[model samples]
Target: MNVTVFGATGAIGSLTVAELLARGHTVTAYARNPAKVPASWAERVRVVIAEISDVQAIDSAVAGAEVVVSALGPSMDRTATGLPLVDGTRHILAAMATHGVTRYIGHGTPSVLDPEETPTIQTRLIGLMGRTLLPRAYAELLGMTDLVTSSAARWTIVRFTAPKNTPRQRHLRVGFYGTTRIGFAVGRADIAAFTAAQVDDDTYVGRAPAISH
Candidate 1:
């Protein structure tokens, strides 16, 4: 598969790129700073530098790619800035559609899931607090969810809770809307592994899988 990963220099993006390459897929890592892309991948993959929010730039970066993966978390802690998530996601989706690319895997927060089905009061409270304190982010994520849900392409929105820095466990628990506390905590590598896996399988297409370790 020829894969393009947006925000490829980010924490999760970098790992996903590596995993994809390890699996022998041709990977393209897209980021604003090409220097941020690892030197090791320089020879094996193509690096495209451009702002993800720019429609033309995104279109060019994803062109000719079989699958698009987005790990586009805010560069900085934006709990206070309250930047928009859906707008960026919309741009990516639009770019993909324009380029005639269909398969997509997007990284999303667990807070976007309904709180009623969450495992414990703590998880629900945290999600509620996030919605209260960072309403814009949550709202935009909701919009992103709606867009992906409505899109005609094959898409998987991987909803994850606290992302740990631990090593890859190679284990994951996946659940859809009805599963409570499906995604409580997961390692970054584990998330990357699943993301790479999704490029080949349409198992999660048109579904939001809450992932946990």
Candidate 2:
């Protein structure tokens, strides 16, 4: 499979690229600074340097990908206010549509999913904090979700709880918020594994599944 990963320098994005390569899939790591990509991966994957906001650059990068995985998130810089995630996603969808690529797998927080699943007190509190403290980011994430849900391509949004740099358990609790009892945190490697696995999975297409543990 030919995979193009946006925000490839990010924690989870880098892991996803490594996972894809480990599974014998060709990968294109796209980021603003190619230098950020791990030196070890240089020989294994192709590197494309470009900003996600550049639609033409995105279109060219996504041209022949069999699957596109995005690990983009709100900028750590507080002054940044534009909807990069939403805008980047729109470009990705448009490019995919133009290139005939259907599979897309992206990551998000559990706050984006419904809390109707008899969520524990911890889950509710986390969701509340995310909405209250990062309202703008949450709004952008919602906009991104709207764009994805309305797109013509096959998409999967993997919602997760707090991610830590822990070892992969290879075990996950997966389902909608109301149906899946997620843990407080999950390993970044596990999240990458799940994202990579979705490339061949149709069960989660068009749905956002909250995963943890």
Candidate 3:
């Protein structure tokens, strides 16, 4: 499979690129700073430099891609009001549609949904942060979700709790969370593996499943 990964320099994005390559998929690491990608990947994948807002750049980057994976989010330098999630998603969907690319997988936050399991104190605090302290970011993510859900392509938005830097467990609990319970902390490597696995999974297409270890 040919995969184009947006935000490829990000923590989880980097791991996703590695995981895809390990799975023998051709990967294009798309980022604003192509140099940020690890030197080790130079011989393994294609690299494209472009801002997510640049539709033409994105269109060109996604050309010939079989699957598009986005790990885009607000940078710490910017506040929630400046998030590129919504607009970026719109551009990605448009590019995919134009290029006849159908599979779209992206990362999302658990704050977008109501807690179905008994809320841990940590979960409650995170929810409060998203709804109260980071309302703008929350709203932007919701808009991104709506855009993806309405798009013509097959899409899967994997919502996760806090992403940690721990080593990969290779074990994940996947659920809609409306009826099932998952953990609150997941390793970044695991997240990448699960997201990459969706490239060939139709079960989660058109659905957003929250995952945790």
Candidate 4:
């Protein structure tokens, strides 16, 4: 697979790129600062310098690639909003459509899934707070989902719950949107491996699934 990964310098993005390359897939990684990529990856995979918000840049980066994966995230700041995640996703989808690339996998938070499941009180409280307090980020994430799934493309949105830097494990749990039970913490490497697996799995297309240990 000729995979193009946006946010290749980010935490989960870099892991996804490593997993793809370890599988012997040719990867083109898009990063704003190419120098931020590890020396090993810089030597192994093709690195393209570009911002995800730039449509032309994205189109060129993913050209000739079969799968486009995005792990883009917005850093939290009081003065900042989540426009980067929302707008960057729109630009990525537009580029994919224009370039005739149909397959996409995106990183999202598990918190945005609709609460149809019988979740623990702790999880339910968190959702309520997100809806009432962090509405901007919540709305942005939901909007991204709507754009990706509605587009003329095959897309899987992977929602994750985890504290940072957890260790990888086989047989990680998957919770589909609206399913019962909240997912526990999962490792970053596990998330990468799962995304890599989804490259060929049609089962997850147009759906959102939460990943955890």
* Whole-model lDDT, model 4: 0.78
Considering only N, C-alpha and C atoms within 3 Å, which residue pairs clash in candidate 2? 117-178
What TM-score goes with each of the models?
Answer: 0.86, 0.91, 0.89, 0.87
lDDT of each: 0.77, 0.83, 0.83, 0.78
For residues 36-100, what per-residue lDDT tens digits would candidate 3 score against the true structure? 87999867888988888888989888999999998876554334356576898899999999999
* Candidate 2 residue-wise lDDT, 1-213, digit = tens: 999999898999999888898888999888998678798986888888888889999998898899999887776455678888888899999999999999888877666654234565665787687778777777777788778867887888888867899999957788765555667788999999999888777888877888888
Model 1 ranges with Cα > 4 A deviation: 75-84, 114-126, 177-183
| Candidate 3 local lDDT, residue 46 | 89
Which model is ahead, 1 or 4, in terms of TM-score? 4
Clashing pairs in 3: none
Model 4: per-residue Cα lDDT over 63-89, one tens digit each? 889999987765545466656777888
Off by over 4 Å in 2: 114-124
Worst 10 residues of 4 by lDDT: 113-122
* TM-score, candidate number 2: 0.91
Error of model 1, residue 175, in angstroms? 1.9
- Any residue pairs clashing in model 4, and if so which? none
